[model samples]
Target: MNTDPRPSEHASPCDAAADWFVRLHSGTVSKADLRLFEQWRQADPEHDRQYRNVCRISGAAQHLSAQALRAILKQDAHPATPQQHRRLSRRAFGLGLVGACSSVLVMGVLHRQGLFDEPLETYHLQTRRGEHQELALPDGSILRANTDTLAIARLYEGRRTVELRRGEVFFSVARSTRSPFIIDAGSTEITVTGTRFNVSRTDSAVQVAVESGSVEVSGGRWWNRRTRRLAAGQAVTAYHDAAPEGIRTVDVTNIAAWQRGDIIFDDTPLALALEELNRYLPHPVHLDDTALRSHRISGIVRSGKPEAMLEMLPDFAPVSVHRQADGQIRILPR
Candidate 1:
């Protein structure tokens, strides 16, 4: 017998519930199967929760308009149901219906729209890995998509909405009282009233740097912690598992210069600055010297040249930057 406290067989029901949900979302299940699924869902609380997760993901897919869906599908070949609906092949379709229906594209859609209901029209723009793009929104706001960023946005009725699920983005708002905009980045909520700023959220924390105007940041509390508001020329960072910390006044112009193809750092630790600089290069930059990790860097780096960044690092620290044949950058102590 297994000694672990967790019920080993508990996951099977959840997995099965997820499968039933995908079929329901794809509109493939017959009426009889739908009744059977409802029976299964009502049987247990875990089944209901698992089914909701699947629906939330699937609902996001349905929110994408016909034009956008076709465009996205065109970029990649999606498995479509045949007109006659033959039996699934036993070889390639090894996971059966689960793998085929629970695709990233469909799940991503659900994740975006399932946050709220009532069909709030929002405008959105995004870019792929190794790519950066900019666009002007319907509300006259300007959006800059950092590499590997995806955004969903809309300005409808009386509210403006923008959702950034990953990567970094800079927003320059046009200012509208009738529709105060809100941005959902991970667990942080940024409310804007005609301001310019940049927000970056990673797996660990969320960083908000203000260029112009003030913004409200809420819900980064840890136990009895308090929320912080960031003003122009200020930056604040909030991380998971810890209370939000660090409120500093910095030059807004230098911080915002990355939008103009310049990377600037001011007494920033090499380890932290390396994380920001690596975003601009095709190949990732890594530090090999443990001793050089804590060195502080303050300078301007041109965005396009990885080799130039490597060369400039030798001036501030006792380290040499080397480029491997495979294109990854490695930093070594000199």
Candidate 2:
């Protein structure tokens, strides 16, 4: 559905992947653009392999100079499993599991026969509004939980699982020959050996993006079950009932921009861009005129910074920003 020009049939995979990488990183991503990207990647296995190669080289080369990048990747490229007696809840257990917050604690489940196969290590990872948390897994993996995220990580002898109850999580999984890292997010599930990727879950859909290595994403509504493999630099969004569409090439760099406390928008509809910005703001933003929803805007604004984001409205559209005594932000047609 994307109108962008694509590579020729004879074009090399690197050329095609490089083109996709540029488009995705241009700062605006659309369902149609991603859909078309999926088609290209799914058309051939070589496409995916080459795309991953481009992402690895680009990410390491560009991001390696940053201190934050060094921390996330120094142990990333260096980058788990388990089996137990087979008796476990295999689910997050607690009344607060559905609450706004939960504590990180280990269950005192007793092991039989003093068998040292391995004990399950479970962690309740969460962050409040405008908050971010970074954690290190026992297997040397790193988890970056984004704003208002709630996920549970469980480690067994041959399997490692993270149940994403809500929010987004970026994983740098440690390589393991025997164990596979699994992520359960709503109806979606992702499996990998060792990879760096991002998983974002909402009530309706789940999104998966691979930064390095590859991942298998599977999930659907109760009526359908879909599975799709995503190579590094590729992403896919699965809805509740839709089938596995395909893999879309994405910007492996900006996918984790929240780590830098910023959000980028490029010619995105006002309504859609507001929806993403509201995720970081404690107070919701409102538009005084519903008709202005279709107005498109583009800019870089710090995450959760209402003033900086709203001030640019008039520059892009005939809208003026307003603030209410009740701490509400709104936009009025100029």
Candidate 3:
């Protein structure tokens, strides 16, 4: 007596098996129901094959939690009853189906890259949700990349240069007055010899915070270039598509605390705080409303406290924080 289930020649068992596949794995099916399902599947070899194929489809998507699956289902706008929902669950959990969906997302991104070309060896450096990193360069320089920070190093000629694509970094220069270090943040170019300073590239402007030593920041129209000398404790901002703003003095240690795996928000905006917090951990943190994000917040957040950081946020702002299964934090207006 072969226990292998074959598909029914009289009726289509594939669809039914698919529904069962999801229900069986959902931890709700009773032992009696499971026995019945097994009996039905083992009735024929075709039934067995059909059920296995259906299960295969949903197995690939196991990384998606039940909540995410339900969200996707809800988006379909199908008025599905609880029983019908169970029927569709198998397709939702199948690995092959989920992988196929991911492929579509990747294809969309790649298509946007170019019509017939793709980038070669894309480099990315990002801080985790609640983590920060102090990257030491080969040239003996140090980069204190803040939370949710990313910098791409591009080598050219005798000079070492880095492009601050997003977030902030404190560069500690080593003595090698010969090879000058340059950092490009948006329209601004920060040139340094043997100095230490912080550089942040936000959507609004590019900021330079100098610590030890000095640096020359230059930016403006392609033809007209303006430069400013920033001394220790001095900071400057260069606006987008505009000239360099005047420089001012600030606490060097407070601005460079990310290097020590800490974020000090001195009445800073909530949105900015979340952006800084996203650097260290492997999770994402999102800010919802501009008004709520603009609220002032002051606190000292240590590393590896993503939950604690989020819990403290409500005290400063009228917002709600939710944890996603993929380790992402969602902030919404209360």
Candidate 4:
């Protein structure tokens, strides 16, 4: 139902893939763009590989400053000799840009930096509505729990496991080949040796998004186990009674913006955004107009501040917020 330009036949694969990446992130990706991307990927194996590499680089770059990014790009563009390459590599390693440019080499660099070699500790964590918490795991990994979430970590001789009883949690796992970190979210199981990712669970569905590194998502009934390998910028959703959806590329930067105390809605359905915002608000928000539920809205609202989110609704959509006598906020057509 949407239209977009296709990559030129003569363009370099990496350049074409980069263009597609920019277009997709522009917040207006059409089905036509997706089809064109698929065609480009199918036309050459290198296209798919380059696209994945670009995604990894972009994910890693999210943590870097503008000046650091410019320095890395400059070094990459004009490394004249072997010595220059070596110098650039060292600079990259020092700036943590090595992982963005090359994952294979960054593993050794990370080892030398002692990122994954640390002592372990067991922990149990939870947070109520309007609350957020950061936790350091036994293996030096980090966990950020969102509102109304419950999680338990158990580290044993052979394995490390976390049970996400409810709500959402983001993990920055430390590499441990001897004991892979596993998260159990209802009917879904996610296994990762080292990665940054987010997991959210509801009564009907479970969702997983990989920000960096990789994870194996496996779940379903015992008789029919299904699995998917998700790379950086990829996400998967599975329902209790349905097969897991295929991997989909997403804006990893926006997936868990709540970690920054903000929630972003990019043309998201009013009903869905309201549902998410309600998780952080003590007073529930209700919709009086069923028609307004499906209306699209786009904005960034401060997390845990329902009033701020409610006040901005009219700026983007044909809706108004009214505070009821019962202390609940109701949204209706203006």
What's the count of clashing pairs in each model shown? Answer: 8, 10, 30, 2
TM-score winner between 2 and 4, please give it.
Answer: 2
TM-scores for candidates 1 onward, in order: 0.58, 0.56, 0.50, 0.54
lDDT of 3 by residue, 1-334 (tens): 3122322344456545644554454434466767878888787797787776665444222322344333332233334445544434444455244322222222222222221122232234667444467767666777777666789864444456677888887788886676677787766788888898888876656778888888999876433447899899888778766778787778877767765666676766676667656654467788867777668888887765645778887887788888888878799988
Pairs that collide, model 1: 57-110, 60-109, 60-110, 122-153, 122-154, 123-153, 123-154, 124-153
Write the residue-wise lDDT of candidate 4 on 1-334 in tens digits.
1133565677677666655654454434567767877888888898888778657544332222234433332233332455544655576567555333342232233333233332354688899987889889767889999988899887766567788988789999999888889887766788999999998775556778899999998766533447899999998877664556788887989879888888777665687677777777777888778888779888887775756888777888898788888888888888
Higher-scoring candidate on TM-score, 2 or 3: 2
- Candidate 1 lands at a TM-score of 0.58
List the candidate numbers ranked by lDDT, top first: 4, 2, 1, 3
The TM-score of predicted model 4 comes to: 0.54
Better of 1 and 2 by lDDT: 2
Residue lDDT tens for model 2, 113-188: 1112243788889998788998899998899998879998889887787889888889999999798888877557
> Model 3 off-target regions past 4 Å?
1-140, 144-158, 175-179, 201-206, 219-228, 237-246, 322-328
Query: Any runs in candidate 1 off by more than 4 Å, and if so which?
Result: 1-114, 128-132, 146-148, 155-158, 201-205, 219-226, 240-242, 288-294, 332-334
Worst 10-residue stretch by lDDT in candidate 2? 99-108
lDDT for model 2, on a 0 to 1 scale? 0.67
Who is ahead in lDDT, 1 or 3? 1
C-alpha lDDT score of every prediction, in listed order: 0.65, 0.67, 0.64, 0.71
Model 1 C-alpha lDDT per residue in residues 1-334, reported as the tens digit of each score: 3222222344566556544644443433357766777787788897777666555444343333344443433343343344212322232244333333344433343333333333356556777655778979866889998776778886656667777787788999889877787887755667888999998765556678899988877543222234578899998766643445668888888656766777777876687677777776788888877777678898887767645766788888888888899989888888
